[model samples]
Every structure is written in structure tokens, then in C-alpha cells.
Target: MKFNATLLAQFFHFILLLIFLRIVAYKPVANMLKSRQEFITNNVAAAEEDRKQAEALRQQYLADMQKAREEAQAIIQQATKAGEVQAQEIIEAAKTEANRVKDNALQEIAREKEKAVAELRDQVASLSVLVAGKIINQTITPEIQHGLVQDFIKEAGDLPC
Candidate 1:
């Protein structure tokens, strides 16, 4: 084998170029890659934290909505109960009013019946007096009749006031 000066010089120059590239370009590129990886990892962690917070907020919102629904249902129930009570009270009042009206009608009818009976008794008494006067005119003497008239007047005057 023959050794050449040019080939030896070229080999030395290639090794020196490799050392310069490793110191200047490769090291700086590796550092830049490491910094970019760290930045990406921090961004992913922040996104995960945001997701967890969002999930917690969603659960809280759902709980609040459920509580509100329960409250609304309770209010509706209370309103229904109150309405029923008021309706019952109104029905009771109407029944009471009806009973009172019936009682008043019965009382008025009784009063009217008593008035009719009194009028009928008065008519009967007047008829009896007329018959008795006809009998006295046919049979009694004038002196007897005058004495009876005076006696009837005295008896009527002496009755209770």
C-alpha cells in the first residue's frame, strides 16, 4: 500500500470538522429540543388541570339545578294544599248559609200558620155570636134582653185588661 499526503490531510480535516459541528451545532440543537419538550409538557399539565376544574364546576351546577327543582316542586305542593283548604272553607260556608236560609223559611212559615189560625178562630166566634143573637130575639122578653145586655157589658168590662 502506498500512503498519500493528500489523503492524510483530508482525513485530518474531516475529523476537525466533526468536532466543531458537535460543539457548536449539535449541542445547541439538543438544548433547544429539551427546552421545547419542557414547554410542551407544562402546557399539557395546565390543560389537564383546566379540565378537572371544569368537571367540578359542572357537577356543582347540576347539584344547584336539582336543589332548585326540589324547591319549585315543594312550592307547588304547598300552593295546591292551600287552594284545597280554601275551596273546602268556601264549601263549608255555602252549606252553613243554605242551612240558615232553610231555618228562616221554616220560621216564617210557622208565623204565617199561627196568623191564619187566629183569623179563623175570630171568624168562628163572630158566627157564633150572630146565631146566639138571632135565638135571643125570637125567645127572650124585652126586659130580659135589656138586663142581659147590661150584664154582658159589665162582664166584658171586668175581664183582665
Candidate 2:
């Protein structure tokens, strides 16, 4: 084998060039690409975590909203029941008042009836006495007077007077 100086020199130059490229460009580029990949992976992981947190928050909010709705419905139902009870009590009170008024009216009517009956009896007695006095005054003869007196006594005895 013949060793050539030109080929040896050329070979040395190529090796130096490769070393320079590796030092100046390849290594830095590879490192940059690796860093970029790591950054992208970290970002993806962070995004997934954020998404999971957001989903959890959404579920919690929905649960809270459902609980609030149920509580409101319960409160409304309780209020409705209480209102119904109050209404029933009011109706009962009204009925009681009506009964009392009816009883009072009946009592007043009975009192008035009693007063009317007593007045009628008094008037009848007064008229009967007046008629008897007129008949006795009209009798002037002794015999008629004696007979009239006897009749008046008998009639008066038969009455309440």
C-alpha cells in the first residue's frame, strides 16, 4: 500500500470538520429538541390535571345545585302544609263564630216571643176588666145589680185575676 500525503491531509480535514459540526451545531440542536419535547410533555400533563380539576369542580357544582333545589322544594312543601293548617283553623273559627251568632239570634227571638205573649195576656185581662165594669155600671135596678154582681164574681174567679 502506498500512503499518499494528499489523502491523509484530506482525511484529517474531514475529521476536524465533523468534530466542529458536532460541537457547534449538532449537540446544541439535539439538546434544544430534547428540551422542547420535555416542555411539551410537561404542558400536556399540566393540561390534563387542569381538565380533571375542572371536571371535578363541575360535578361538585351540580351536586350543590341539586341539593339546593331539593332543600327549596322541601321548604315550599312545609310552607304549603303550614298554610293549609292555618286556613283550616281560620275556617273553624269562622264556623264557631257563625254558630255563636245563630244561637244569640235564637235566644233573642225567644225573649221577644215571651215578651209578646206576656203583653197579649195583659191586654186581654185589661179589656175583660173594662167590659165587666161597663156592664156593672149599666145595671141600676137592685135585682139586676145583685144578679150582675154575682155573675161578675163567678167570671172573675174563673180568670187569672
Model 1 stretches with alpha carbons more than 4 Å out: 1-18, 134-161
160 Cα displacement, candidate 2 (Å):
22
All candidates: TM-score: 0.68, 0.69
Off by over 4 Å in 2: 1-18, 131-161
Residue-wise lDDT of candidate 1 within 21-76, one digit each (tens)? 99989899999999999999999999999999999999999999999999999999
Clashes of each: 0, 0
lDDT of 2 at 34: 100
lDDT for 81 (candidate 2): 100
- What is candidate 1's local distance difference test score? 0.85
